[model samples]
Target: MDSKTGAAGGAKSGPRVRFAPSPTGYLHVGGARTALFNWFFARHEGGTMILRIEDTDAERNKPELVEGILEGLRWLGIEWDEGPYHQSERTELYRAAAQKCLDNGSAYLCYCAAERYAGGDHAEEEGAGGKVRRVVRCACRDGKPTSAEGQPGVRFKVPLGGTTRFQDAVFGAREFSNEEIEDFVLLRSPRGEETAGQPTYQLAAVVDDIAMRITHVIRGADHISNTPKQVLLYGALGAEPPVFAHLPLILGADRTRLSKRHGATSVTSYRDEGFLPEAFRNFLALLGWSAGGDQEFLRTSELIGKFSLEHVLRTNGVFDRAKLEWFNTQYLQKLPIEELLPEVEAELKRSKLWKEEWASGAGHEWFAKTVDLLRPRVRLLPDFSSWSRAFFSDEFSYNEAAREKFWKKEPRLPEFLGQLAGALEALAEWNHDACEHALRGVAEAAGVKAGVLINATRVAIVGEAVAPPLFESMLALGRERVTGRLRAALPAVQESCKA
Candidate 1:
């Protein structure tokens, strides 16, 4: 969909953006995608991207989780150009903005009990005359700020009669009525064991956006409802609102909003499960956005060059995990051997499948060749270790299904393996063509088709029915292991791997 019908549009140049996430948990996929979009917009326009931590909720904020979130962004190659400005550290900014609202009569003091608005931010309550409203405003309209002892929380005032409207880049023109809007809490006064008052999310976010001079706000569509409130806050502070582009929500394959039942939602979960960062970034970029055409694969450089809010999808993106795996598979096959090497190495090391021999020299040559042969067959980084575990170690199990299919079908497997192993051991120079010649000769002597030996040899060599080409696989696994595994799989020689 190339429709840019109502795009509020891009900044002139050097637009500032921010990816503000609260440090409550790991950076989920949706949050990661938002960060990616903001990052793409910033990089596309050569602008500054600020990382802001909205950690004002002291009781729920985990200091340890902040680093995890940062790590996730870094892992996705979403490096910020500015400080991961913590909202808690910037209370002066929010407090000052709240006071300006109070001084200007845009805000008021609520002498009501703290329990009056107990549900916290975005919580609605019944107003006068049994009417329901999004917030509880002070009856007297006493404009003031939070105090330490006789603490009465502050709230921004909503205009009695008017509608707040702003243009969205993806979803088009949107409006929220002032009468329907809530005079939500601006600063919550601390009680029991506490120090300073905390600015509500609306105040802190608006204040920071204004202070940071952010020109564009590219975030998830879930925050669309919060925008009108923030717009009011910006107007109260006499600041211009940024260009808002609320990205469509990412849903699961079932078309439901993404959640745990849909699969692992965190970015690190994919990272830990062997996803390539470039591939993952490429996949994340396509969710709720497009560079156009049948081209699914986009490099980071390509994405930065092509990314525009005009192409941002109005429809919610479906998080097709199978499609993501397909993307990972393509990268595994197409990326340079050098680029895939370290990732495979790291994966192998993690799985305890790595060898000291793969470090350098002739052994390194063998390792490199093995990766080349295995790369096409690999889907994930762990596949480098799991799919081809036999390449790294002496001990690896044959697939049960492979054993039943290939081994059970060939009654002469022991004789055939013994014959093939003998033929292989007698090779002068070991390579694909030479190994092929040996196998064919063995099959001819056994008076059976090469397919029989090929099947047995495959399961014996790699312990998997499907693998890289048999001859090349023999070369990568080297002359010794191939012949050894074949001989070992023989019932007479060793019943350990007998079908």
Candidate 2:
């Protein structure tokens, strides 16, 4: 399985890479990172990036999973120049390769039963030092080639001795001794039927890569062990092997493999949780590769300009949620108001937090204003639901603690409200600046700090002390709702002051 002489040949005219994800489940974060790297490499070099769905495992593959992979890529803005070709559709190609290997004597039939192997014993045997080796010896290698009840089960004959070596773009040169790997099965069957037998991933992947003319194979480091087998397959088929680069694994904060226990692992989960695609892409790109210095955020084009296989680190990376959120905030703050408005509306509607009257009759300018007010404060879509609740509902639910602490206990509350209402009613302009000046005057007359009066007014009108800028919130709420909530809160304020 030695790497061919021309393997390290200079860069091809047009680099070609493929993101071949098995449609086994949702598009996981690890898979998304691989896709992003491939896409960046192809785009940077003005080459082609292909989307190939490895769906040969019928029992594991799902149609919805295929849709999920496409949706995830589209969400990340990772477009492919070539296919989303399905491996199942190309069975004829795999069959031809298997037949060629068989005809060339590179592969043969093995029908050994599971019990015939040396390690097949169920009972444990103790050695002289109480040590036992769970060794599995091949029955076919011993000249007693068993057949699968007269049905053929294909097996590749691995050449003995020597070593298989390849220079990995990220991990550098690596050599795997041939003695460590056993000659594995190429095709198998559940039943003793010809139609049931089919080629496994090892053979299918090699055939597909050759057929697709993939110039570079970029994938996770976990597949490093599978590379030699693939290289051997390429040699057996008389095909050239693609350049390989295995990315480091993404680990949890605990330095373990990422899983559901760590956090959201799938791309759709992040999208639903209000993560921006650009931010997600930026974060994934930096996981195993760095752009140097303290720079964290980069646009897709900027990422392409800086990306290279040599920059990718061989060490595993921890998927830090805080860093991801920080990146999301950067992208969120830069979002154009026009583009953010629809997302805000959609999130509100999806969460059933939007009022039909306000959303439909108020028009886009009003919505834009609301989004502008909330944009700087919002980190995620769900934040808008709670933060902007006062904007949607007419009746405000004043926090009991705030009412007791600020509004209810303040002396001369009625006089302050009466004076403030009179000043607001007499004003020609009811905008934020005018409202602020008028309320500040009332606070001065009452011998209280502006914030004190402002806090009370905020609770009276919006039902919460923590809200948008007090004056801006009041103007957006309109005069009717503002006066109504304040008037309703007056009696409660007066009663508490007396008590």
Candidate 3:
């Protein structure tokens, strides 16, 4: 669609959309969701996706946060095909656009005090059976002395009548009366003419969208009210408004807007917490969108091919923390072991479980097997270190609750496992079958259930009562380390037995 005509044209080129994020804070889920949608739309249509930093508000701008936003986008595998244009550097373009609106009589200079508002000392008339309504609420909106005084701010001259109608891609037709729309500011007044204050979002957005020829405006539904006002600015600036597709807001379990209380809203925080990039993207893509069918696990290419504004839910997307983990688990289980090995290795490094030998050579196969064995039960990459830490290093923490449960169940639990460890050490071949046979033989002779010995030995091996299959876990822990940890726990278990 062409920006000037707002018409669907031939196959000259595809949509030019942009994710213009304000670097006021870290890139959170809401911003990342918008970027993901924009990327999906662009890639699906074989068009360009531009990254624009809307950093005009210098007072709130954190230059450090800009890199964070970029990093989050790249981490999500959402790459742009064009420039990461900064609004800070485009102040001249905004100034010129505002000047053009003023010259064309579509905007006016307001010399009102710093406290000027949309409804305060402006025009008001009684409308429809004793209702006082505000219309064109700016003092200099009409033919007043258009002074560049009061460090005058420029305000758009909204039509006093008629309705501003636009077809929203998701919500369909939406109309707002011109009288109900406020005479919004284009640019804030400057302390002096030499330094013009930054353009308001109302003006800068329309100006930048026009300048960049953005054919689509895909953003959160929170900007719905701002659309009508921006639509007026687009008309006043003699540019057609882009096709607007407002996404539903992401909500918590209680249906309120997602925040810190909703848990870890930062995109990079999810990365730090070991959410796979593809899994994260899949989770975000499904937040407000549906690719049909009952299948929720869609690949990036699948998401791109299936994404459309038609399927975007008008209702808010609920961020289910458990559902996100489910997606991560699915990826963990199905992704290639080689692909998962590095992620597991990085996580081990973070937890100080990394060893150079485990990355390659003789130890590499064992590391890969350990990862593959544990991946089925993991929901995130960090679990490789946290849940199965003993597989990589012996300095793993034993859960006191689990330890006490097993040690106290049978005071002689250590005796049972010690004998089982010695039986395993005497094995002709050290493997899963031999270990299991040895452990069962010791349990049977001692008149104890094999499960008792299994649970107790698991705590001794992995420092936790729960893990992947016992024989598999023991195999990954290897024959020597398994026997060594079991024997090493004897003194601690002996102390617990007396207690």
Candidate 4:
């Protein structure tokens, strides 16, 4: 079977990986990278990719964030094969698994109330591997069943000796001694507001993974601490746990964890800022994994073909915003004009610069040519509306800095532009060659360098000191608008020159 369709082919098909996210906030970039990695692995191995929502904590989980998570995943083009199953919906499944652990002597009930330990002075104790840990051991471990029904929390019965070890697909063999793991809570019994029994994350995650037949657990390395406990839970259920792969953490340029201070953490934020989805995916792929060569820019299909857990680096990946912008620029140049026009048009409309006449015929052709001319100059989608605004609307203002530098340099600027505009207007053909000939002739008549006339004209027409090439820009702007802009800027040029 072909790799693309290999997941469903034979009896022994492929791995089943999952991208489980909590609905506490919008899907951040780190979470998006995790989702992408899982998707890459699933597609590479011809396996299923599932989307699970770990929303057990209803109090902290915002309902609106569920949409954001799904939307972000869709925006990244990471499609899931299985459900967006909610842990909230499967409470009974977790409860049944907890009961099985109790019956098989793998778990016990703790009657110790949290209030008793509140004021107690408990020193930090050394756990397995000689690491310091805050351990809260229950007093009910003397093999006594609680008489009070459903009033105590259920804790897992960790083995007394030996270590729990699992082979991580990315980081290799990882071992955690049982002593390091406290008898963590599984099911919390009825309390003040939470009258109904609820399954803790440790319990719910393990149970769901087992039920869903997840063949590989691919997530961030921050969850490495919880893997051993999960491994024990999988053993208690008399089931084999899936392969674990802990991804490296995504850090900022300061080498710290990625956060709001790092800028544009959310996938939706990048989309709003005019980052192409393809470029964003490529950027995420390079964060922790690479193709093992010097190829920096990769398409999505190439990524799927080259993706492997072995290439993923164990070192933390830095979230470089500047690198992301560079990737955006590359993608802007690669995509066809027709494909990018819709987004550019949308941005124009959003900025109130779009005209109804630009949808078809000559006006449409002009807009397409303008986009082609400005494509290389743009780094983001919003740049089209901001940097290329003069192409779309006549209401654009001169950048103050550009005005001070170009127009304010001399009063002769308006006369030079006037001569050039007159020459350009009188041309039979208003193309790039005609525009350049007219401007060069005017410069020769004024006894000034060609660059002086060209730079001044650029500032006059585009309201900026920098843009696409002068003649090309004017060619796209057309003769009528170009002459009108020169006449309009003549007053500002005279005023700034006097100042």
Candidate 5:
């Protein structure tokens, strides 16, 4: 289809779209989701996805924020084909377009001063439905200036009569009357001069889309209000507007628009919080579009094949924290033990649980085994350090609740655990089988069920009531550390039992 005309006339290739983000701060989740949708659409249609930085407002655009947006995109696995064109670099294009609009009588100069909006002075002017007008069109439509104080600002002359309509890819047909969209500003200057802030978003966006030959525009639904104005600009420039796909707004649990109060708005925060990139991408995919049926966990490649603009939900998608964690857990479960080891080791080192000896020989094998044993219980990468505490360090703390329930419930638990430790230490083989046998032997001698001794040993060796498995956890901790922790924990158990 021809991007300019929105007609089916193209035979060269597929749609071309761009993910334009303002570098005001870190790439928020809403922006990231928009990028993902655009990426998936481009990939699915065999088109191009361009990264455009809408940093036209130099005063508000921070140089440091560009890197964060790029990092967030890279982390989310959303790559682009063309330039990360910054609007700051394209001032000439916007200036030329504004001049074209002015020469064609589609735009005029406005001499409205800032002081005119002071207090209730401007409220007397009535608008539609006899309400106080917020936007007052300038009386300079005849190419003449009213005030000689300073240069006037340029405003796009909204064509009189009729309604502007477009077929939205996601939301279907949308219409806006010319009366509803007043003569909005194309350039902001106190005097009638082309200066900085001359090209507003509507003008700059239309100019960039035409220059880049973008065939599709997939953005948040909030931009729906800006679409008609942009379409009018395109018509004024004698260029066709691109196909518009306004995605549903993402909302918080409270059903309001997602924001900082919604928690961790930036995509990098999720990256920093141990969320796997693939998992996050999957989560983002599900935010607005679905693959149909009960299929939730999907790879990026799979999503590309299944993603369709038609399937995008019209209602606002709720950002569910539990659902995202579920995706993270699923992704973590698919990772191999070796892949998880380095991260686990690094976390261990950071928490002072890492022993230099574990980097080589049998210690390395033990570390890998420990990670494998603990992987089943992990939800995030950081959980390796917290959940596998007893595996990497001998000085890890015991769970007070476990100490109370498992150790204190049986007054003779400390005595039994001490005997079980000696039995475990005396074993020639310190594997899972031998560990289970030793515990059962001790339990038989003490006239208690094997489960009772197992629970006590779990509290002693792993310092928690919940771990992977009894025999496997003990085997991963090794017999020496197991017996040592048992001896160390006996006094704490005795004290807790007395309490």
Candidate 6:
């Protein structure tokens, strides 16, 4: 296979792309965007998408982080056709590739001491500056490279003269001169008392991509600099290079890279916060690429149908919180009640407000009613759990201001509450319309506006000024709980009157 002509001899039978992420931590928002672009490209072209976990660095790799990567992908609805392949599992493949390069004289083992190559000290300096500049002064360049048994690092011999150039689908043509690059380390001897140090990421990734038959490598623009190195490795292995597309970086609103400081960069964090998978995918897809037009929301199928790798932007795009919130609201409203139930339940469980009986027992109807009442008012399902707290538990803590303003000041507050409670208790049909009529009668008889009675009742029950509709909230809360809240609020109302 040639770099210009991919596998299948330049035949455009769609393109196979892979999202190769190192399992170091939770998948960051930047990595999520790369995954989305790769997913979009694969689906759009009717190609295969693979999820490869590049867990080559044993120190940094955690077995648990594999679940995080899969969870992130599942939450974003980015499915892969192949595997969640781990590089550690494929060590033999990388070792074979390295051996082939060594046997062909394209790679050699060097016995350079740590001090001579500036390892620890240089690594520290680069860390402080938030960049890595590895100085690989190859000791085996002219010394007639040995078979190299113990304590040696492998280095690829990069070709001198001319530039390594490739056409990127998003950033257009990119070229890097050979002088700008040095012979990089491919493998290092084991450091610990046990086990040998394995192949580096630069080597492992190139070998894995080629072995996996990845046709197009769709990833972030931050990795654009590493492309030439991998291209050089491809040549060293006597293998063809894959088509590369470096999608733009997603920045925070402050124009910095998206990180924890920007708030909730992980896919699990977003999902836990009640973002729909489709909406999250839509938000991620629009961060650097778009289907064109005023459309900001799209289903996975719609996105796949209209997606084009060439339409992806080269410039960095800011991750706007407002825009994501807007997208969330859209999905929140459009989602069916059945689809929204599990999310609502999860949020409740996370908040420790979840009751098994409420989800699985006679309380099921009440839970459904609660979701229905708050669905329109909420932008996220997690919001309903926090906001609708008073509905679930009898331990309602009223807002002090709401107690003073609505509960205390009104002279006929107790009388109105008593009548409303009595009417609610006598209701044969405890539905929205019936409850609204009964509550309104109490307000009319008290010679006050409906809002006055509604406000007082809401504060008495829900303990918050802003909530779902008053009557529906009361109906969902039930007669016993509603009366109990009203009775408990009486003393607070009297205290406010005295004050």
Best by lDDT: 4
Model 3 ranges with Cα > 4 A deviation: 1-12, 117-135, 145-149, 192-197, 261-263
The weakest ten consecutive residues by lDDT in model 5 span 1-10
- State in Å the error of residue 400, model 2: 5.0
lDDT of 3 at 285: 92
Which lDDT tens digits does candidate 3 get at residues 104-137? Answer: 9988887774545433445567878889664557
TM-score of each: 0.89, 0.87, 0.91, 0.91, 0.89, 0.84
For model 4, name the residue pairs that clash: none
The per-model lDDT (C-alpha) reads 0.82, 0.79, 0.83, 0.84, 0.81, 0.78
Model 6, global lDDT: 0.78
Query: What value does the lDDT take at residue 277 in candidate 1?
Result: 95
Off-target runs (Cα >4 Å) in candidate 1 are 1-13, 115-137, 142-149, 193-196, 492-499
| Runs off by more than 4 Å, candidate 6 | 1-14, 115-139, 144-150, 189-197, 261-263, 352-366, 423-440, 479-484
Question: On residues 158-184, what C-alpha lDDT tens digit does candidate 2 reach at each position?
Answer: 676788887688988878887655566
> Candidate 5: where is the Cα deviation over 4 Å?
1-13, 115-131, 190-197, 336-368
- Model with the higher TM-score, candidate 1 or 4: 4
Q: What C-alpha lDDT does candidate 2 achieve relative to the native structure?
A: 0.79
Off by over 4 Å in 2: 1-13, 113-137, 141-143, 146-150, 190-193, 353-362, 393-396, 399-405, 408-415, 488-499
- Mind giving the per-residue lDDT tens digits that candidate 6 earns over 244-361? 8888888888999888898888888888778878888888888878787888778778888989987888889998877887888887777777777787888888888888887765
Kindly provide the TM-score of model 5 when superposed on the true structure, using C-alpha atoms.
Answer: 0.89
